[model samples]
Target: MTDIHQDPGAATRQEPGATSRRVIQEFWRLRWVAVAVALVGSFVYWPIIDNFRVSLTHQDIFTGETSPAGLENYRRLTEDPVIGLALWNNLAYAVISVLFQVFGAFLLAAIIEGLGSPRARAFWRAVYFIPSAISTTVTGLLFYFIYQPGMGLMDGVLQGLGLGAWSRVWLGDPDTAIYAIIAMSQWQGFGYAALLFSVAIQKIPAELYDAARMDGAGALRQIWSITLPMTREMTGLMVIITVTGAFQVFNEVMVMTGGGPNNASQVLGTWLYEQGFNQNDMGYAAAIGSLIFAVTMACGLAQLWLNARRRVT
Candidate 1:
């Protein structure tokens, strides 16, 4: 019988070599991603985690002291009447922004893109986009002046049209303050959204529109059948962004009214600022921030899930 002898050293040596190869392969695969992972952890994830930690503790900014507060800050958020008002304002802001910035902008973009002349299309696109290119602070200040009681442009136009009685102190009154800010927001922001929708519309193949036209489809019919469906992804993305922006609105409100007229225009962002910097309630501010984070995170996750569902379906 032939003697079979196992080389134990050979087996051991081969095993080590195989394991080393796997280790090297893993390191090579992750080499490029390591820096991105580290940066994201350091900047985004770490700040979020630290914010949550801060939300659970009360801090005296002047004295540089912090103490555990548990869920007290969150509980306080529930009891605060301003919080409820701010949430309602934010919801209104979201609803109005979606209507104008997302859907309205889509329609405007379709119309602009459908223009017979390329120069006309380009001119109109530039005109609409000018407001968005302007700084938000500058727009806010401009609108602030326009909303002035008697001297503003709105009042002048109303007076010119014999509708002077309709004009009021747009930014000073509690009943009209938030809506005024919302209007300014729509004016400044719809242009940007329309620009985005215009790009999306441009990506649609001309052949699709030609096919629709050959089937006796008019402009509106073609838009409904071809454009809307083609731009659904952009519409969905715009809705998410608009809603997030509505909730996070601060600049216009701060510049125009500072959440004034009895805090009537206070959104969560302004309210958080009011609590943190103005009132020196850092813990409560962090809690408010947490709520904002929760809302924006939900919006982002919902969009992701919708996209995934669409892909699966």
Candidate 2:
């Protein structure tokens, strides 16, 4: 009251010190959390950074000697025909996984969600998801037996059904090896995707479906109009996860065909493993690992961007 015409300069002069003190207090409060995050980040990222650095140097696996090779490892990777084959296989695997793992799972989830009884839904979900619970190595070995030439379960079924002519060496043929692995992968993985989609589907409001039904929408129409649109985010997520997993396929190839039949089923993951462990080309393997990391990150980022853009629109 006495200083009704207070100086604007006085308020301005006090503002900076107040802001500085506030910032200092906030930092003090969060100092331990910041320190912990930094420590964890350093621990987690040091190996990745070291791998990138190692990719630039030639390292003797037996003697533990390393020499600067610059981009020679990347050059070798570019020129290698097996690398090209592995890249193509990875692409094909990703496409198949997107189709079956993501889309197929959506269909399965819809079917399960449509069940009249809760017990029936639960039973079918468990049945479908049981295969995913089995170890990947065991699944690979089991499929290896099923795809064995002339005497496996698949061939036996073909014979029993009077389709013996259709039978062949599923995992041993150059033409069918990768496809067989893809099929096995789908059988093992699609259920997990289905379970995820089912959960997402459940989160969608029942009122939406009721409204659609009131509007005389049939089952298929309701699914197309309401279910699919509602699960768009989940579908995008599944695509990202499936594509990433497909590109990193290894355990199945290792256990089923060992990237065999003249490397017909080779994927980047198995190729990297072979280069590092078997061939002892640590630098080349590191380069391949770096490439994989780059590709996977790019794909995931692109997917996220597209989804965000869709939402914004």
Candidate 2: how large is its RMSD? 2.1
- The global Cα lDDT (0 to 1) of model 2 is 0.90
Candidate number achieving the greatest lDDT relative to the actual structure: 1
Question: Could you tell me which 10 consecutive residues in candidate 1 have the lowest summed lDDT?
Answer: 304-313
lDDT of 1 by residue, 1-313 (tens): 9999988877557654788899999999998999999999999999888989999999888898999999999999889999999999999999999999999999999999999999999999999999998888999989988988899999999999999989988998889999999999899999999999999999999999998888889999988988998888888889889989888989888988899989999999999999999999898999999999999889878987886666411
Task: Check candidate 2 and list the clashing pairs.
Answer: none
The models' CA-based lDDT, in order, is 0.92, 0.90
Q: State the RMSD for candidate 1.
A: 3.9
Q: What is the lDDT of residue 227 in candidate 1?
A: 91
After superposition, which runs of candidate 2 have C-alpha atoms over 4 Å from their true positions?
1-3, 15-20, 29-40
Candidate 1 stretches with Cα past 4 Å from truth are 1-20, 310-313
Candidate 2 to truth, TM: 0.93
Cα lDDT tens digits, model 2, 186-228, are: 9999889999999999998899999989999999998898889
